[model samples]
Target: MNSMPYIDQKGRVYKYGEFFPPELSPFAYNETIAQEYFPLTKEQAQEQGYSWKDPEPRNYEIQIKNNQIPDHIKDVGD
Candidate 1:
Protein backbone atom coordinates (compact mmCIF):
# COMPACT_ATOMS: atom_id res chain seq x y z
CA MET A 1 0.00 0.00 0.00
CA ASN A 2 1.44 3.30 -1.09
CA SER A 3 0.80 5.87 1.57
CA MET A 4 0.37 9.45 0.38
CA PRO A 5 2.85 11.64 2.20
CA TYR A 6 1.90 15.03 3.62
CA ILE A 7 4.37 17.58 4.93
CA ASP A 8 3.56 19.70 7.95
CA GLN A 9 4.53 23.29 8.76
CA LYS A 10 7.47 21.96 10.80
CA GLY A 11 8.58 19.94 7.76
CA ARG A 12 7.39 16.73 9.38
CA VAL A 13 6.03 14.18 6.95
CA TYR A 14 2.85 12.31 7.83
CA LYS A 15 1.29 9.63 5.69
CA TYR A 16 -2.22 10.32 4.58
CA GLY A 17 -5.01 8.13 6.00
CA GLU A 18 -2.86 7.27 9.04
CA PHE A 19 -4.00 7.90 12.58
CA PHE A 20 -2.40 11.16 13.65
CA PRO A 21 -2.77 11.58 17.38
CA PRO A 22 -3.88 14.74 19.20
CA GLU A 23 -0.25 15.48 20.06
CA LEU A 24 0.22 16.14 16.36
CA SER A 25 -1.94 19.18 16.11
CA PRO A 26 -1.78 21.81 13.28
CA PHE A 27 -1.79 18.93 10.82
CA ALA A 28 -5.12 18.85 9.06
CA TYR A 29 -6.64 16.52 6.49
CA ASN A 30 -7.17 19.37 4.08
CA GLU A 31 -5.72 18.36 0.73
CA THR A 32 -5.98 21.87 -0.63
CA ILE A 33 -3.07 22.92 1.55
CA ALA A 34 -0.85 20.09 0.32
CA GLN A 35 0.45 21.94 -2.70
CA GLU A 36 0.80 25.39 -1.22
CA TYR A 37 1.30 24.74 2.45
CA PHE A 38 3.32 21.53 2.10
CA PRO A 39 4.86 20.71 -1.24
CA LEU A 40 7.50 18.24 -0.08
CA THR A 41 6.92 14.49 0.06
CA LYS A 42 8.78 13.44 3.20
CA GLU A 43 11.90 12.93 1.14
CA GLN A 44 12.14 16.57 0.09
CA ALA A 45 12.12 18.19 3.53
CA GLN A 46 15.77 19.15 4.08
CA GLU A 47 16.89 21.81 6.50
CA GLN A 48 20.43 22.35 5.14
CA GLY A 49 19.30 21.26 1.70
CA TYR A 50 20.89 17.83 2.02
CA SER A 51 19.56 15.87 4.97
CA TRP A 52 16.00 14.76 5.67
CA LYS A 53 14.54 12.96 8.65
CA ASP A 54 13.38 9.44 7.92
CA PRO A 55 10.34 7.88 9.50
CA GLU A 56 10.94 5.38 12.30
CA PRO A 57 10.50 1.80 11.29
CA ARG A 58 7.39 -0.04 12.45
CA ASN A 59 7.62 -2.14 15.61
CA TYR A 60 10.34 -4.74 15.19
CA GLU A 61 8.96 -8.27 15.23
CA ILE A 62 9.84 -11.84 14.43
CA GLN A 63 7.24 -13.67 12.35
CA ILE A 64 6.57 -17.17 13.58
CA LYS A 65 3.61 -18.93 11.99
CA ASN A 66 1.46 -15.81 12.62
CA ASN A 67 2.52 -14.11 15.80
CA GLN A 68 4.30 -10.78 16.06
CA ILE A 69 5.49 -8.42 18.76
CA PRO A 70 7.98 -5.64 19.21
CA ASP A 71 11.55 -6.78 19.85
CA HIS A 72 11.89 -4.41 22.75
CA ILE A 73 9.08 -6.14 24.62
CA LYS A 74 10.46 -9.53 25.55
CA ASP A 75 7.99 -12.34 26.20
CA VAL A 76 8.91 -14.12 29.42
CA GLY A 77 6.48 -16.85 28.44
CA ASP A 78 8.80 -17.67 25.58
Candidate 2:
Protein backbone atom coordinates (compact mmCIF):
# COMPACT_ATOMS: atom_id res chain seq x y z
CA MET A 1 0.00 0.00 0.00
CA ASN A 2 1.26 3.48 -0.82
CA SER A 3 1.92 5.72 2.18
CA MET A 4 2.06 8.96 0.26
CA PRO A 5 -0.85 11.34 0.27
CA TYR A 6 -2.70 11.70 -3.01
CA ILE A 7 -5.23 14.22 -4.23
CA ASP A 8 -7.75 13.60 -6.97
CA GLN A 9 -8.67 15.99 -9.72
CA LYS A 10 -11.49 17.40 -7.64
CA GLY A 11 -9.13 18.19 -4.74
CA ARG A 12 -10.17 15.25 -2.52
CA VAL A 13 -7.21 13.93 -0.55
CA TYR A 14 -6.66 10.21 -0.13
CA LYS A 15 -4.24 9.88 2.74
CA TYR A 16 -2.02 6.81 2.93
CA GLY A 17 -4.35 3.79 2.60
CA GLU A 18 -7.37 5.70 1.30
CA PHE A 19 -7.66 3.18 -1.58
CA PHE A 20 -8.18 5.28 -4.68
CA PRO A 21 -7.76 3.44 -7.96
CA PRO A 22 -5.83 4.84 -10.89
CA GLU A 23 -7.36 6.03 -14.21
CA LEU A 24 -9.07 8.86 -12.36
CA SER A 25 -6.58 11.19 -14.09
CA PRO A 26 -4.33 13.83 -12.61
CA PHE A 27 -3.79 11.74 -9.48
CA ALA A 28 -1.57 13.86 -7.26
CA TYR A 29 0.70 11.89 -4.96
CA ASN A 30 2.67 14.56 -3.15
CA GLU A 31 2.56 17.74 -1.09
CA THR A 32 3.04 19.96 -4.13
CA ILE A 33 -0.34 19.07 -5.58
CA ALA A 34 -2.03 19.35 -2.23
CA GLN A 35 -0.58 22.82 -1.83
CA GLU A 36 -1.56 23.81 -5.36
CA TYR A 37 -5.11 22.45 -5.36
CA PHE A 38 -5.94 22.33 -1.65
CA PRO A 39 -7.36 18.90 -0.85
CA LEU A 40 -10.93 19.04 0.40
CA THR A 41 -12.89 17.19 3.05
CA LYS A 42 -16.22 15.59 2.23
CA GLU A 43 -18.10 18.55 3.66
CA GLN A 44 -15.81 21.01 1.87
CA ALA A 45 -16.32 19.14 -1.37
CA GLN A 46 -20.08 19.51 -0.97
CA GLU A 47 -19.68 23.19 -0.10
CA GLN A 48 -17.68 23.66 -3.30
CA GLY A 49 -20.51 22.08 -5.38
CA TYR A 50 -18.63 18.85 -6.18
CA SER A 51 -20.54 15.58 -6.07
CA TRP A 52 -19.05 13.00 -3.70
CA LYS A 53 -20.29 9.44 -3.53
CA ASP A 54 -19.75 7.65 -0.24
CA PRO A 55 -19.29 3.90 -0.31
CA GLU A 56 -22.12 1.65 0.81
CA PRO A 57 -21.74 -1.32 3.10
CA ARG A 58 -21.15 -4.86 1.79
CA ASN A 59 -24.69 -5.74 2.96
CA TYR A 60 -26.01 -3.36 0.34
CA GLU A 61 -26.37 -6.36 -1.95
CA ILE A 62 -28.68 -8.10 0.50
CA GLN A 63 -30.65 -4.91 1.02
CA ILE A 64 -31.11 -4.42 -2.73
CA LYS A 65 -32.06 -8.05 -3.27
CA ASN A 66 -34.75 -7.58 -0.66
CA ASN A 67 -36.03 -4.60 -2.68
CA GLN A 68 -34.67 -2.32 0.01
CA ILE A 69 -32.75 0.42 -1.72
CA PRO A 70 -30.73 2.52 0.66
CA ASP A 71 -32.24 5.85 1.61
CA HIS A 72 -29.68 7.74 -0.40
CA ILE A 73 -30.79 6.11 -3.66
CA LYS A 74 -34.38 5.46 -2.62
CA ASP A 75 -35.73 8.17 -4.89
CA VAL A 76 -33.70 7.04 -7.89
CA GLY A 77 -35.90 5.78 -10.73
CA ASP A 78 -35.41 2.23 -11.81
Candidate 3:
Protein backbone atom coordinates (compact mmCIF):
# COMPACT_ATOMS: atom_id res chain seq x y z
CA MET A 1 0.00 0.00 0.00
CA ASN A 2 1.26 3.50 -0.78
CA SER A 3 1.23 6.32 1.79
CA MET A 4 -0.67 9.52 1.26
CA PRO A 5 1.27 12.72 0.61
CA TYR A 6 1.75 14.58 3.88
CA ILE A 7 1.04 18.29 3.77
CA ASP A 8 3.19 20.25 6.21
CA GLN A 9 2.18 23.21 8.34
CA LYS A 10 3.96 25.40 5.80
CA GLY A 11 1.94 23.70 3.11
CA ARG A 12 5.06 21.87 1.99
CA VAL A 13 4.60 18.47 0.42
CA TYR A 14 6.64 15.48 1.56
CA LYS A 15 7.27 11.80 1.04
CA TYR A 16 4.66 9.63 -0.62
CA GLY A 17 2.42 12.35 0.76
CA GLU A 18 3.93 11.48 4.12
CA PHE A 19 6.11 14.12 5.80
CA PHE A 20 9.91 13.63 5.79
CA PRO A 21 9.48 12.68 9.43
CA PRO A 22 6.26 11.58 11.01
CA GLU A 23 7.01 13.80 13.99
CA LEU A 24 6.36 16.81 11.75
CA SER A 25 2.89 15.67 10.78
CA PRO A 26 1.21 17.82 13.44
CA PHE A 27 3.00 20.95 12.26
CA ALA A 28 1.81 20.40 8.74
CA TYR A 29 -1.78 20.48 9.82
CA ASN A 30 -1.24 23.31 12.27
CA GLU A 31 0.51 25.41 9.67
CA THR A 32 -2.38 25.06 7.33
CA ILE A 33 -4.78 26.35 9.93
CA ALA A 34 -2.52 29.27 10.80
CA GLN A 35 -2.31 30.30 7.18
CA GLU A 36 -6.04 30.12 6.75
CA TYR A 37 -6.45 32.51 9.64
CA PHE A 38 -3.80 34.90 8.23
CA PRO A 39 -2.75 36.18 11.67
CA LEU A 40 -2.74 34.08 14.80
CA THR A 41 -1.26 34.29 18.29
CA LYS A 42 -0.35 31.43 20.58
CA GLU A 43 -3.87 31.46 21.98
CA GLN A 44 -5.41 32.15 18.60
CA ALA A 45 -3.36 29.33 17.12
CA GLN A 46 -5.12 26.92 19.42
CA GLU A 47 -8.47 28.55 18.81
CA GLN A 48 -7.88 28.37 15.10
CA GLY A 49 -7.40 24.62 15.49
CA TYR A 50 -3.64 24.08 15.29
CA SER A 51 -2.62 20.92 17.13
CA TRP A 52 1.19 20.92 17.24
CA LYS A 53 3.12 22.77 19.93
CA ASP A 54 4.44 26.21 19.00
CA PRO A 55 7.46 25.93 16.67
CA GLU A 56 8.72 29.54 16.72
CA PRO A 57 11.04 29.11 19.69
CA ARG A 58 12.51 25.89 18.39
CA ASN A 59 12.89 27.30 14.90
CA TYR A 60 14.67 30.36 16.28
CA GLU A 61 17.18 28.19 18.12
CA ILE A 62 17.75 26.15 15.00
CA GLN A 63 18.36 29.28 12.93
CA ILE A 64 20.76 30.68 15.49
CA LYS A 65 22.68 27.43 15.71
CA ASN A 66 22.82 27.06 11.96
CA ASN A 67 24.13 30.60 11.52
CA GLN A 68 26.71 30.41 14.31
CA ILE A 69 30.34 30.15 13.29
CA PRO A 70 31.91 26.74 13.62
CA ASP A 71 34.05 26.01 16.71
CA HIS A 72 37.12 26.03 14.49
CA ILE A 73 36.50 29.67 13.62
CA LYS A 74 36.34 30.68 17.28
CA ASP A 75 38.99 28.23 18.49
CA VAL A 76 41.68 30.36 16.86
CA GLY A 77 40.65 33.34 19.07
CA ASP A 78 41.55 35.76 16.28
Candidate 4:
Protein backbone atom coordinates (compact mmCIF):
# COMPACT_ATOMS: atom_id res chain seq x y z
CA MET A 1 0.00 0.00 0.00
CA ASN A 2 1.41 3.39 -0.96
CA SER A 3 1.08 6.14 1.59
CA MET A 4 0.07 9.59 0.42
CA PRO A 5 -1.51 12.80 1.65
CA TYR A 6 -5.06 13.46 0.58
CA ILE A 7 -7.52 16.28 1.17
CA ASP A 8 -10.79 15.26 2.85
CA GLN A 9 -14.29 16.62 2.29
CA LYS A 10 -13.72 19.19 5.02
CA GLY A 11 -10.50 20.44 3.37
CA ARG A 12 -8.44 18.60 5.92
CA VAL A 13 -5.39 16.60 4.96
CA TYR A 14 -5.18 12.88 5.65
CA LYS A 15 -2.92 9.98 4.99
CA TYR A 16 -4.35 7.60 2.44
CA GLY A 17 -3.27 4.11 1.45
CA GLU A 18 -4.37 2.16 -1.59
CA PHE A 19 -6.79 4.88 -2.53
CA PHE A 20 -5.64 5.70 -6.05
CA PRO A 21 -5.48 3.56 -9.13
CA PRO A 22 -2.05 2.51 -10.41
CA GLU A 23 -2.65 3.92 -13.87
CA LEU A 24 -3.14 7.40 -12.47
CA SER A 25 -0.10 7.32 -10.24
CA PRO A 26 1.96 9.58 -12.52
CA PHE A 27 -0.58 12.39 -12.36
CA ALA A 28 -1.18 11.78 -8.67
CA TYR A 29 2.51 11.90 -7.83
CA ASN A 30 3.16 15.09 -9.73
CA GLU A 31 2.85 17.83 -7.12
CA THR A 32 2.86 20.64 -9.70
CA ILE A 33 0.08 19.05 -11.72
CA ALA A 34 -1.86 18.19 -8.60
CA GLN A 35 -1.87 21.78 -7.43
CA GLU A 36 -2.88 23.05 -10.85
CA TYR A 37 -5.45 20.37 -11.76
CA PHE A 38 -6.86 19.32 -8.41
CA PRO A 39 -8.83 21.34 -5.94
CA LEU A 40 -6.95 22.16 -2.76
CA THR A 41 -10.03 21.33 -0.66
CA LYS A 42 -13.02 19.05 -0.97
CA GLU A 43 -15.68 21.71 -0.64
CA GLN A 44 -14.42 23.65 -3.66
CA ALA A 45 -14.11 20.51 -5.72
CA GLN A 46 -17.70 19.54 -4.97
CA GLU A 47 -18.84 22.98 -6.06
CA GLN A 48 -17.03 22.48 -9.37
CA GLY A 49 -18.98 19.24 -10.07
CA TYR A 50 -16.42 16.78 -8.83
CA SER A 51 -17.54 13.93 -6.58
CA TRP A 52 -16.26 13.21 -3.09
CA LYS A 53 -14.22 10.34 -4.44
CA ASP A 54 -12.31 12.62 -6.81
CA PRO A 55 -8.67 13.11 -5.88
CA GLU A 56 -8.74 16.81 -6.58
CA PRO A 57 -10.40 18.82 -3.82
CA ARG A 58 -9.55 22.53 -3.86
CA ASN A 59 -11.24 25.59 -2.42
CA TYR A 60 -12.18 27.92 -5.27
CA GLU A 61 -12.92 30.76 -2.90
CA ILE A 62 -9.43 30.56 -1.56
CA GLN A 63 -8.13 30.31 -5.07
CA ILE A 64 -10.05 33.39 -6.10
CA LYS A 65 -9.01 35.29 -3.02
CA ASN A 66 -5.44 34.29 -3.64
CA ASN A 67 -5.79 35.07 -7.34
CA GLN A 68 -5.09 31.50 -8.34
CA ILE A 69 -8.12 30.88 -10.48
CA PRO A 70 -7.72 32.45 -13.89
CA ASP A 71 -10.12 35.07 -15.29
CA HIS A 72 -11.78 32.51 -17.55
CA ILE A 73 -12.59 30.23 -14.64
CA LYS A 74 -13.87 33.12 -12.57
CA ASP A 75 -16.14 34.19 -15.40
CA VAL A 76 -17.62 30.75 -15.97
CA GLY A 77 -19.47 30.39 -12.64
CA ASP A 78 -20.09 33.99 -11.74
Question: Candidate 3 at 51: error in angstroms?
Answer: 1.8
lDDT of 2 by residue, 1-78 (tens): 355677666566777655554324343223234425777766765565444555556753343554565567767777
TM-score of each: 0.21, 0.26, 0.25, 0.21
Worst 10 residues of 3 by lDDT: 17-26
Q: Number of clashes in every candidate structure?
A: 0, 0, 6, 5
In candidate 3, stretches whose alpha carbon ends up further than 4 angstroms from where it belongs are: 1-25, 28-37, 56-78
| Native-to-model Cα distance after best TM-score fit, residue 39 in candidate 1, in Å | 33
Question: Residue by residue across 18-49, what tens digits does model 1's lDDT show?
Answer: 76632354443223345377566544534313
lDDT per residue (tens digit) for residues 24-71 in model 4: 344332334554665456565445334444457765654345465556
Clashes of 4: 5
Poorest lDDT segment (10 consecutive residues) of candidate 1: 45-54
- Taking all chains together, the TM-score of candidate 4 against the true structure is 0.21
Where model 4 places Cα greater than 4 Å from the true spot, the runs are: 1-37, 54-78
Clashes of 1: 0
- Highest TM-score: give the candidate number: 2
What pairs collide in candidate 4? 39-57, 39-58, 40-58, 41-57, 41-58
Instruction: Report the number of backbone clashes for model 3.
Output: 6
* Worst window of 10 by summed lDDT in candidate 4: 21-30
